[model samples]
Target: MAQSSSKRIFLCNSCGNEYFKWHGQCPACSEWDTLSEFHPPKSRRKSNGAPARKTTKLHTITHKKDRKRTSSGINEVDRVLGGGLLPGSMILLGGQPGIGKSTIAIQIVAGCGKSALYVSAEESEDQLALRAERLGINTKNLHVSGENEIMNVLEQVSVVQPSLLVIDSIQTVYNEDLDSLPGSVSQIRDCGQQLLNACKQKGFTVIVIGHVTKIGTIAGPKMLEHMVDTVLYLEGDERYDHRILRSVKNRFGATNEVGVFHMTSAGLEEVTNPSELFLAERTANTAGTAILPTMEGTRPILVEVQALVSKANFGTPQRNTNGVDSRRLSMLLAVLEKRLGNFMGMNDVFVNLVGGLKIQDPAADLSIISAVASSSKDNVIADGTVLVGEVGLTGEVRSVARIDQRLQEAAALGFKIAIIPKGNMKNVKSFKGLKIHGVKSVREAFQIIF
Candidate 1:
């Protein structure tokens, strides 16, 4: 038979956009070096062994479906994974180097108590065993292999037939059929597709550990996230002992849920009461500190927001922020200077969310503004007061989501006063053992708190 001729094309791994030729950057997503040479799917030849069976109707088929999930015996991981691990589900876990990605994977396998196969392209078998021993995990059913070739890993999977399969650092895995090297756009895409297909064919749960880029995103094509059933990001500053496991995308459960863990010499341990842990060492009456009740998915956590305003000797004032967006800090500063006539423009300001946990909740806006104001005036806020509300560009305070939950958490944490948006106050009948102060604008918030 004559070989079928196929045209060569260039594809953007980020947006799935194809181009006639290669370019330095992807025009669709503006990501540099994301375009790679594409290969068309090879046609499969039919075997001479058996004939194809007729398709059955959906209603006529009778199957015993098992919807039960396998629990990893770790409450923090279970929470982030939405109860437990579902069979045949593909999960992509991404994190920076030395962020306990492998530690968590081995812990989960040990807790599952079932047969598990771990394939690593980054670490040696002896290295994995040593870490596992240090973590106090002794699971006889867990199998380990150090294979970089995708085909060989699949072959081992066939022989073992384990219930759980884990791939350490998917970027290191490469398919021999692909011309591109490992970690390239084409190799990552092809290897991920093949692993996902194999997982679906076999009834086993698979978790793929991924490397993050310099910008803190998963080091692979954007389609790599879309192809998985769940995408989780393990985030936390290396200098701090606390780590947060956050779910960015989930097909089977809710997203934006977070799991807090503290790194110990043994391994990662779950923090049941994150609010207490975050505010344990906070000073009683600090000028630059403000506590805020923020919601992390279904759970409410109270975190301290600290700010510092100092005179800048240089011409250009510096704006530094940790565990928060710098752009957001700049916007808050502009709002303060415009609406409240604050002297934030001439001074250098630094804002930090305590415990090294990143917060995207807009409800903390009021707390941030108040912290800056408190620092500028050098006046400490009253003890047991928690701020919760969003600040609009027009200086008006906006209502946040889950107001009741936030108030309840604050009250349970021994907070005596709660400052919230006026809109959120009208709907709340009452808060137990807590005083609710409603504010319509940033000026009103500062007057009530500062």
Candidate 2:
């Protein structure tokens, strides 16, 4: 076999396109100033004629009995993983610097209850030990190392032969063969590929911690995300103690699954019932407030939607929202003004979802409109009332998916009344201690609530 010489090339960080020369704009993605220098590893070729690779028929391949998933010892973590962690799978955990990425990673490693190696490229062994102690983890099976060299780390892995391997971060480790510095596009791609290969061959689970860019995406080429088996993100506001662990991509589990946690003095504690936690501090019988039953993956949760409308202070009415889509709020406001009257056009509107949860459920559309209308009219929605439906452009209340599940969750939380889309009424089986009101239009809903 002969090794081919490696060449320096340019790569677009946005689209992962290769270029022989640097350009201000990437030709593939049309993104400006996203190209960076990269050195691809040398390739090996056989001196003699190449032989055909072996192949196996898909139907003939049998599943291994020992390939079953094992619990990570954390119920919330296992839930996001669709039950448990599978052996030989590569997972990526990414989040902001202080948003508890390392905390959760260490917790998972400690809870795996197996011989594990923790490779920390950015922290010392002492720092890791302190963190483990603070989290009340005292396990002899977990080994800590401060190596950042990719080859040396692999050598340690070979020596340890542990069932689990964790890389504190993918950005700080670099391959010696590549001239690019650590965290560079070339280093991340090459090192990540090497880890993936090792995970597949050695049959040990690997969890790689990755940093996110300012835009909240994992920092690296888009291909890096495609190389992992699962991608989890830790998100929360610095001002709040609530944290959300969400799965955006998963090969074995359903995506968009979320696990709620609260930051405590000791460590992150899982919230068993997020609905109760989110509505714990609700002000009863308050104007500009509505309850919405939304679904996160297969779990149904009730979140509070609040809105405030005031007279415009400036030339134009100010429209601001937190944890709610700005465009959706604008459209809802327009609907309220056109369908109802010009009340909102002359007022400033602000809508916020309690508990720092950002929801994309269209079932919240009716809730948002209800809250906004309640604030504008200075009237409070009745106690123990929840709204679930999608508001269309023509002010018609549209049906939402999983209406039965949403209503059942609301009912379990002691919600006495529910305003749902008329189209979904047939799907409701009726629950004890709860009353359902079906509305055909937003006007009808207002008439009933007011």
Candidate 3:
């Protein structure tokens, strides 16, 4: 077959590996059958800008913080957006289907109640209108354009000159310039690049709503994330209505600064203090329940950790955890069993982060082990104690990062007792009002808490 050739590249979405041809397996991330071919549009032969933008020195780059930003009028969005949308900035918001990525984008664009353009290759205007009705957002300022073709979408963007622009999804926008179907690797890369370029040149705030794969990666070329200024992931268990907008990448502010939103009759409602929502109302004190303080961006949050210990029925012990890594939990359990000799080897240990938000940080390790030990021993931890430390495989309690920040955050939130590492304890010496306990090993940790 004669290839009507276009210079293109195949990128592994799992690892950001770029290749000349598609492969059955990724050479980098070792993900099976995840190669997606992408054909990017060559810059228009004649219309390309001359004297390409020069890379300026770091100090030479002008700082213009005082520049005005058009607020989306949604406090949660504004906070997640680092005060508000920077003119011509491209923001990517990825989430599960029907998890309200579109809803939040639509809500944000509805600001100023001015005519903002909403382009959706996925949903028709009628469908979007129905959603708007359900959300009760008056779409008066929202100019709706339903299209699949990238050229047509660009045309609408050029003609409307909307103050705010929202693409319901980046995956569905297909480009005729790319020799592939929409949502394919090539098409997504080309469409995303073009949209980002247009956003920068046009000075219109653009939010590209995206869909994520089951493994929690944005369902497109990894280049899509790099090409944008901000990348936000909307997280929540599909069975639950609450959604978390977490900044995975941010050029304007801190990544990991998250805003909590609950999907409801009105729309995505912001939860100012997510701690209350994460902690269930427990009338009575229970063993194996721990509250830990974590710093998300600049905000401090208190989350509950629960664990249960039962006699293991099988030859090998079974370890399970929710909203945390099972392998890490297993290692922590092993530390407790081997070094501390807490008789947890045959226990069917189960650990859970009260809310469904997955915490991959190593700091949660000590709490996981503590929760399980507390359960096994049937001892309840103090109400004010907040456990924060990394438990090593050898049963040593490693110092956690940003102890001062954690302590300050914990102190701000009314936590009085903190179980931290010995190294951090020596550095701080004294934690003024809060009773900070330093533990070197898992045994010490247990003794200090229980």
TM-scores of the models, in the order given: 0.92, 0.94, 0.88
Where in model 1 is the C-alpha error above 4 Å?
1-8, 25-27, 30-32, 38-65
Tens-place lDDT per residue, model 1, 378-414, is: 9998999999889999999998988999999889988
lDDT of each candidate versus the true structure: 0.87, 0.89, 0.80
lDDT of 1: 0.87
Cα lDDT tens digits for candidate 3, 328-364: 8777776877888788767788888877877777888
TM-score of structure candidate 3: 0.88
Compose the digit string of candidate 2's lDDT tens values, residues 1-450: 122224778888888888788999999989999999887766532212225547878756575466788788878889999988888899999999999988888888778788899999889999998898899985689988999988788888888988888998999998887777899999998889888878777789999999999999999887788889999999999889989999999999989899999998778999999999999998789999999999998789999999999999888999999988899999998898889884676789999999889988888999999999999898999989999899988899999999999888888889999999999998687988899999999999999898
TM-score, candidate number 2: 0.94
Error of 2 at 248 (Å): 0.7
Query: Any runs in candidate 3 off by more than 4 Å, and if so which?
Result: 1-22, 25-32, 37-66, 112-115, 408-415, 426-433
Q: For model 1, where is the 10-residue window of minimal lDDT?
A: 41-50
Relative to the unseen true structure, what is the C-alpha lDDT of residue 417 in candidate 2, on a scale of 0 to 100? 92
- Candidate that beats the other on lDDT, 1 or 3, i.e. the better one: 1
Best by lDDT: 2
State which candidate has the highest TM-score: 2
Stretches of model 2 off by over 4 angstroms after superposition: 1-6, 42-54, 60-63
Evaluated at residue 117, the lDDT of candidate 3 is 92
